[model samples]
Target: MVVKTLNGAKAVAEAVKNCQPDVVACYPITPSTHIAEEMNHYYANGDTKTFIAVESEFSAISALIGGAATGARTFTATSSQGLLLMHEALFNAAGMRLPIVMVVANRAVSAPLSIWNDEQDSMSQRDTGWIQLYCKNNQEAVDSVIQAFEIAETTLLPVMVCIDGHYLTHAVGQVNIPPQSEVQDVLPPFKPKIFLDPENPLSLGVYTNPSHYQEFREDLHNDLLQSKEKIIEIGKKFGKRFLRTYGLFEEYKLKDAEFVLVGLGSVMDNVKATVNELRNENQKVGALHLRCFRPFPSEELKKILSGKTIGVIERDLSLGAQPPLYTEIVEALQGTNTIVSSFFGGLGGRNLDRTAIKVLFQKIKSKKPLKEWIAQQKGDQK
Candidate 1:
């Protein structure tokens, strides 16, 4: 099929169409509302399966959880607050191992109640045990959804395809919509290992005390605990068929560089361009863009920066202390043979452009993570 520019919301609905998903349960919210709108339109016109609009984001996920429990493939979409509303049931879905797919449009959580792109919202929920995949562009946003189903179903863990709020969800970009035939050939129809039945009924959601809770969690633990390998495998399969690069991490000219910078989401592009300009001046520097957040790849990260002094830029804050990814990188390299510091910059759409990126790249290796996380970090630390 020919690749084309599509709005992120339209691309999301398009993926659902290609998957021929059995049910779409959703409600309206900024950045995510369009996805539900498009799917509702298609379903009303008989393009795909039944689309149901729930009263709230919570209800939407609740409905999806119900459908998936009944052996139907299901999906939903939401922004920051909407995702928050579904927080309670979120654990239940994964605990039940329903394999639901969700599109998370990144947004700042409110107190001042602003609507803007930020990684804080999703980062806050990282411990919820979802297999989170972050996308830097609209195409990656769409493609991740399709790949999400494969990954989620295989491990029986719900997957979150996270897109930066305005950066991705509102941006227009070229994306090759997988044709119906290819999708059919690839995504096998959903066949649940366990499902709610009437005649063949069995107990589900059975109460478990501390003794069984560990093992119940052990199952959920194993699903995501074993996820790094399966996630890489799914990304490879998606890449082979789609020509889109998906991996534990993506590097730009890191092999010969003495200094490498790292970041995630759309900012990685800016860092890459800055690296290119710096390389022209004989500055040996590169970038490592994180495509996956959950099941952090310690080994791959170490192999890339085993002996090099690298720097990491976080677009979001970690609250109280530390850039989120920075802490993880420090842990990953603690006993290993590598040196990486952290720089925090560009929170809540601060726009860390080429100049800012170049400056960070130039000085990242010299400063510690807390001192350079953002120009703001030093004061906070003091």
Candidate 2:
């Protein structure tokens, strides 16, 4: 399906169909409703094997975990409070190493109760042991979901395909859906190496005394530590099969850039456009977007920012401090003269346009400034 106007939700649904998941579950929520609705459509048409409609996001994921445990290729999606509702289950899915793939339409948390796009929703699950992958556009949104499943299954860990809410979730854009035959050829059916079975069933999430708990936890951590390279390798293979290339870190005009902007999610297109226009006028500016965050490409970031000044446009703010993503960027580029600065923008679906990116360039050219307020996370999730 070569779609020209599908938003992130439809694009993700299309990709799921192309990836041919065995089970998909989700609950309705703003920005994420469409993804579920579309997948439900596919299920209605008999293209999808299982379409699970549940009472809440919590139940939706619970169904997914059950299906995955039964050796079914399972998938689920959520955003904002829906994500928070499923938080405990997120821990269960990861700890049990179910290799479940989820699509998180990144959205802002509520206090005044709003349906808006922000990174906090997924970022809140940073410590849940799920592999977090951010996308720069609809194409990446679709591509990452397919790639996410591959990585998750290989590592026996859950993965979150995080896309900018509203930015990609609502915006109509051109997306390249792979040919059915190619998708099938590239992605083989998911066969669980270990699962719940009648013949031989093993206890999952069992109580391990200090004697074995730490060892399992360490193995999980080490598996994730090893996923950085495996993800890159799987991404390369996925890209080659689909005729797409993902370098894990995408760089634009960073060759001789003095001031560069590093961003994640769908705003990357706007940043790329602004960079091109400004560079034409002799501005030493560029942009580097992080596609994978959890297994952060630290070495690649260090190499790219070596001796170059870079600014991080943080859409997700950190309470009582600079943006959370900004903090990570500074840490990654530390020990180098790279003057990494932080510029926070895009909250509640605010417009982060080319003009805003241009303005950010001016600020970077001058001394870096901090003018954004951090909204405190107030839910029990904190």
Candidate 3:
């Protein structure tokens, strides 16, 4: 392992290079552009095998779909509108069971047009039949990128490793880049069970009549649920080899705590810090950092937070509905006595400092309104 001070984009790019993907297709967008640029540099130096510079995010994902169909290990990166543009291809990639891995520099979607960090970009795609992993820092980003390939190949499902745009993507920190030789031992070459070959000539993603379409959808759903086991296994294997273990979610000071804060992505860092401060003052507050979002981890979450006072802070909103993460946690603890509250903040890169987090903790402790907007003006809580 080699330690280097690098930003999240560069660290992720280095991890991808170590994985030695067969093909890389990307269209440069803010925050995610540096990842593609770094890969291009590797390709120019004859370090990477294939790098395709596509015209748009849709085209970039389309290229990856083609590459994965041919049994090639493929990757791409995108953010904000770029991720939205690839909406159509995202389903096709997942429906076809392509084991492609992509990195999402999580950014806010448009209408107001912001290039800053938020979970809305990836959160919008939660139902698109892909595995989603959230990273808290550059180290987790690098490790998740390396583990993603193995998880994707094992489950035959596309994976999106999401990092908060600008927050982590542009922030430089010390990251440990595992050597290629060690990575190879954990993630070997992609030997797909099926591929596109003229000699074998098979069909994929064909138009299925209503008679069988539902079955295909059902199978995909079941497989996605079952893939959670493979995710855990691969995570444990990686930990054994690299000494850094991961799981569906990370618990910080949750044992015997009366108040718990739940969140994902980079915001959890601030949440954890707030939890520590509150703990010092004997506030009995804790935090849960959700690492795997797509699989949902409802059962595990229910067991951990069943009877506690829970506060979920998220960077995205569902408009007419409650916040996405908060809604899910509510559903997960439906039968339990958990008093769950929803708090939304940091949308479009608004600052979510320790002060805002402490306020969220206090609100949950007092059993205030079930839904509040953190860091927003007082009257904005409608």
Candidate 4:
């Protein structure tokens, strides 16, 4: 194990190299650019074999699909508009069951054109049939990248490992890089089940009729949902190998809590800090961080939050609807008496301090959670 201080993007790139992917497809996009930058450096240093600098995110993912379809371990990176551009390819890759791993530096979608950190980009792709994993810090970002490839290949489903854009991507922190031998032991070289081979030509992406189309969709759905088992299993193996454990969702101080906060990505760090402060002040508040979003982890959430009032903090919205994650929590708690509320903050790279989180917990205590937007901590002079 080698511990080094590295920014999120570079950390992820290093992990990718350590896992020894066969084909690297990348396009430079804000926040995510450094990932490709570092990987290109690896290629220059003879650490990688085939690195493709594609024209656009669409082309990048298209190249990824091509590479993976040829039975090669592949990777790519993108953010915001770049990710949006790859929407169609995203579905195609997953539907074809190509276990390509992508690192999405999560950023807000654009119209007014802002380049900053948020969850909207990846959140918008929730229905694209990809397994989405959110990271809280650079260490986890690096760790998840290695784990992602293993998970993706195991399930024959593509995986999107998401990290907050500038918040995490450009932030340097200590990350323990697993040795190549160790990583290889855990994530052996890719042995694809299906591929485009000429000598043993096999048909892939066959056109489907109405009769089988629904079954195809259903199978994909069930496979993604059932992937939770493989995720947990691989996570445990990773823990045993790397001495770090991860869960579908992480619970912070939830025991005997009256209210619980839920969210994904970097904001959970602040939530944990605020929860600690609130606990010292005799408040019964906790936080649950969603790590794996696509699997939804409804049953686990329900078990942990059955009777507690739930406060969901979101960095993205469904546009005039309850925030995407909050809606999922509500649906997950269908038979429970637990109250669910949505609080939106940190959109477009806005700052969310512990004070704002403290205010949110206070508000949850004083009032039942109504869907609301949080901009500032109370008592701040604007």
* lDDT value, residue 376 of candidate 3: 64
Cα RMSD (Å) between model 4 and the true structure? 1.6
The backbone clash count of each candidate, in order, is: 3, 0, 0, 0
Question: Who wins the lDDT comparison?
Answer: 3
1-382: candidate 3 lDDT, tens digit per residue: 9999988899999999999999999886553559989999999999999999888999999999999999999999999889989999999999999999999999888879888888988999999999999999889999999999999998999999999999999998899999788889799789998999999999889998989999988988999988889888888998999999988999999997899989999989988988888889988988999999988899999999998999898999888888889989988998887889988878888878788888888788786547878776444443
Ten residues in a row with the worst lDDT in model 3? 373-382
Task: Give me the runs in candidate 1 sitting further than 4 Å from their true place.
Answer: 367-370, 373-382
- lDDT: worst 10-residue window of model 4: 373-382
Report the CA-based lDDT of candidate 3 relative to the real structure.
0.90
Whole-model lDDT, candidate 2? 0.81
| lDDT at residue 374 of model 2 (Cα atoms) | 28
Comparing candidate 1 with candidate 4, which one achieves the higher lDDT? 4
TM-score of each: 0.93, 0.93, 0.97, 0.97
lDDT of 3 at 142: 92
Q: What is the lDDT of residue 302 in candidate 2?
A: 87
- After superposition, candidate 3 runs with Cα above 4 Å error: 376-382
Give me the runs in candidate 2 sitting further than 4 Å from their true place: 1-4, 29-31, 367-382
> Looking at model 1, how many pairs of residues clash?
3
**At residue 178, what lDDT does model 1 achieve?**
82
lDDT of 4 by residue, 146-207 (tens): 88998999899999999999899988889898978889868877888779999898877789
